[model samples]
Target: MFSRAVRPAVRAGSLAVSRTAPSNAANFATLREIEGRLKSIKNIEKITNTMKVIASTRLTRAQKAMEDSRSYGQTSNTVFENAETKAPEDKKTLLVVASSDKGLCGGIHSGLSKATRRILQEHPEADIVVLGEKAKAQLSRTHPNAIVLSFANVCKDIPNFNDAQAIADQIALLPNEYGSIKIIYNKFLNAQSYEAGTVEAYSEEAITQSPNLSAFETDEETLANLREYALANNLYWALAEGHACEISARRNAMEASITWGFGPEPD
Candidate 1:
C-alpha cells in the first residue's frame, strides 16, 4: 500500500515537468527567429559597404574639380563686386536655385528646396531659375507666381564650362532685363554635411554704401570680362557640389536599400 502511494506522488511530479517543457521549446523557437533576422542584416551590411566604396571614389574626383576652380571663382566675385558699384539703380532681383534631379540622399534636396523657399518668401518679387528637376517640381507648387526656368537632367551627367556659361548667360542678362541676381546652392562641406550658400548680385546703392571696394581695381572692360568669368565659375561650383551631393545621396540610398534588401547588386 505504501509503494502504491509513492507511485502516485512520482506520477504528479512527472506531469508538472511535462507542462513546463513546452515553454522552453517556445523560447528556443523565438531565439531562432531573431538569429535569422540578424543574419539577413549582416548580408545587407556587406552590400552597403561595397556601395560606400564606389561612392567614395566618385566623390574624390568631384572634390578635385571644386578645389581647382576656387581661384577663378574668387576673381569672378571681385569683378562682380566692382560692377555692382557702377550698376544702375533700378533692377529686379533674380534667384537661381540649384538642386539634384533625383531623390534619396537624406534631406539634401528637401533642405535645399526649403532654403530656396525661405529666400523666395523673403524676396517676393524675385525671378526664379531652377537647375534641377527636383527643385523645379517642389518650388512650382508653393511659388506659383514665381517664374521658373527649368534645366532637366543636368545634375547626373558631366557638367562642363558650356553648361556653366549657359546658366551664367541667363543669370547675367537678368540685370539688364530685371535688375539683380542671386544664386542658391549646396556647398559640399563633407560627405554628410553641406552648407546652403546664397550668392547675391549687389545693387548699386548697396555697393556704394559698403566699404569693401578696395579689392576690385579693374576698369569697365575688365569688369565685364570678370563678370562672365565669375558667372561661369559660379556655375561650375554649383555643378561640382551637385555631383558630390549625387554621390552622397546614392551612397545613402544604397545603404538603405541594402538594409531593406531592395537595392541593386553591390559591385
Candidate 2:
C-alpha cells in the first residue's frame, strides 16, 4: 500500500516538468541570441578602432609633408607670381588630375571626376593626364578618348619629390603639345572640408613670354630647367595635400560606419 502511494507522487512530479520544458528552452534560445550579437558588436568596434588609429597616424605625417611641400612649391613659383605670368588664352590645355590609387575616403576622388567633367564641358579640346588610378577609373567612363596618360601607385603612400619628378618627365615626353598644364587637386581646408582647386603649370612659351622675364639673371636654358622643376614641385604639393585629406576623410568615415553598425538591427 505504501509503494502504490509513492508511485502517484512520482507521476505528479514528471507531469510538472513536462509542462515547463518548452518555456525553459525558449528562454535559453533568447539568451544565446543576445550573446552572439554582443560578440559581433565587439569585433566590429575593434576593427573600426584599429583602422581609425592607422589613418590618424598617416594623417599627421601627411599634414607635415603638406606644409613643407607647399613652401617648396611656392618658392619655385615665386618667379611666375612676381612676373604676373598668365596662361595662354586658348581652350586647348593639359589637365593633370592629381588623385590617388587607393580609395575608401569620402567624395575626394569622385569630386575630381566631377570637376574634370565640368572643365571638359568648358574646354572640349583639352587633353587629360591622370596622376592616379582612382580618378582615371572615374574619368575613363565619361571621357575615355580625352585621357592620354594614366599613372598608378603614384599616391600609394606619402608622395615624394622623386615621384613628382618622374611624372613631370613623362609629361614632357608626350608627343602632343599643350599651351599649359593645370594640376587639379583637393585643397584641404579643415578636417571636415576640402575643395577642388587648380594650380596652373605654365608651358615653356608662357614662361619665356612673361612681361618681366628680362628681370631675372637666368639664361634661356636655366629658365627652361626652372619651368620643369616648378611643375614637379607644384605636383608634389598637390599630391601631399590630397593624401592628407584622404586620410582625414577615411578616419571620419570609419567612425561613422562603426556607429551605424552598433545601432539596433531591424527586426
Candidate 3:
C-alpha cells in the first residue's frame, strides 16, 4: 500500500510538470516574435533616416539651381509679361506636365494630375504632354487619349538646359499646332508645402495678337527663335523648381514616416 501511494505522487508531479511546460514554451515564442518585430522596425528606421539625409543634401542643391533658373526664366518671359500677352480662346491648348521619373516624394505627382484634371474639365479639348513616368502613368489611366507625348527619366537628376531644349525640340516636331502651351509643375512654397502651377508659353499667333506687340519691333524669324528659346527657358525653370519641391517633399515625408510610426511599433 505504501508503494501504491508513492506511485500516485510521482504521477501527480509529472502532470504538474506537463502543465507548466506549455506556459514556458508560449513565453519563449512571444519573446521571439517581439524580437523579430523590433529588429524589422529598427531596420526601417535606419533606411528612412538614410533616405532623409540624401534628400536633404539634394534639396540644397536643387533649391539653389531653382533660384538661378527662376531669374533666367523670368528674363526670357519678360517680353511677354511686358506686352501682356494672352492665348487665343479659339485655339487648342497643350499642357506639358513637369514631373520626375522617381516617386516616393509625397503627393507631388498626384497634385499635378489633379491640377491637370481640373484644367481638362475646363477645356476638354486640351492635349497633354507628360514629362515624367509618374504623371504619365496617372494620366494614362484617366485621359489616355489626351496624352500626345510622354517622356521618361527627364528629371532623374538636376535638369540642365540641354534637357529642356531636347524636349522643346520634340514639341516643335508635333504636327498639331497648339495655341498655348502650359507647363504644369509643383511650385515649392516652403519646406513642407507645394502646389501645382503653370508657366505659359504663347504660340506665334498669340504673340502676334498681343495688343502691345506693335511696340516691340522684331522680325518674323527672330520672333520664332525667341519663342523657341523662351519655351526651353521656361521648361528648364519648371523642371528645376519641381525637382526641388520633390526633394523637399521627400525629406519631409521620410521624417514624418519615422515620427508618425509608418512601420510597426517597437516594444
- Measured by lDDT, the strongest candidate is 3
lDDT, candidate 2, at 180: 83
lDDT of each: 0.69, 0.85, 0.89
Candidate number with the higher lDDT (1 or 3)? 3
Best by TM-score: 3
Q: Candidate 1's residue-wise lDDT over 1-267, tens digit each? A: 559869989989999988776644643458889999899888877867787788778777877776765555666666556544443446566787877676656666767778887877867777788888877877888885785466777767556677888877766555346445677877777776677777655444444444555565645565556556666787777777767766766776776676676663321
Q: With candidate 1 superimposed using the best TM-score fit, by how many Å does residue 18's alpha carbon deviate from the native?
A: 30
Cα misplacement distance, residue 126 of candidate 1 (Å): 0.5
Off by over 4 Å in 2: 1-38, 262-267
Ranking by TM-score: 3, 2, 1
Measured against the true structure, the TM-scores of the candidates, in listed sequence, are: 0.68, 0.83, 0.87
lDDT of 3 by residue, 1-267 (tens): 459769989989989987776544543458889999999999999999999999999999999989988998899788998888999998899999999888777788889999999999998999999999889999999999999999987888898889999999999998898899999998989888999999999898888878887789888997898889989999999999999999898888888888997832111
- Candidate 2 lDDT tens digits, 140-175: 989999999989887788999999999999999989
Off by over 4 Å in 3: 1-29, 263-267
The alpha-carbon lDDT assigned to residue 117 of candidate 2 equals 90
Which residue pairs collide in model 1, if any?
Answer: 91-179, 92-178, 92-179
What number of clashing residue pairs does each candidate have, in the order they appear?
3, 0, 0
Worst 10 residues of 3 by lDDT: 20-29
| Candidate 1 Cα errors over 4 Å, as ranges | 1-51, 79-90, 172-176, 201-219, 256-267
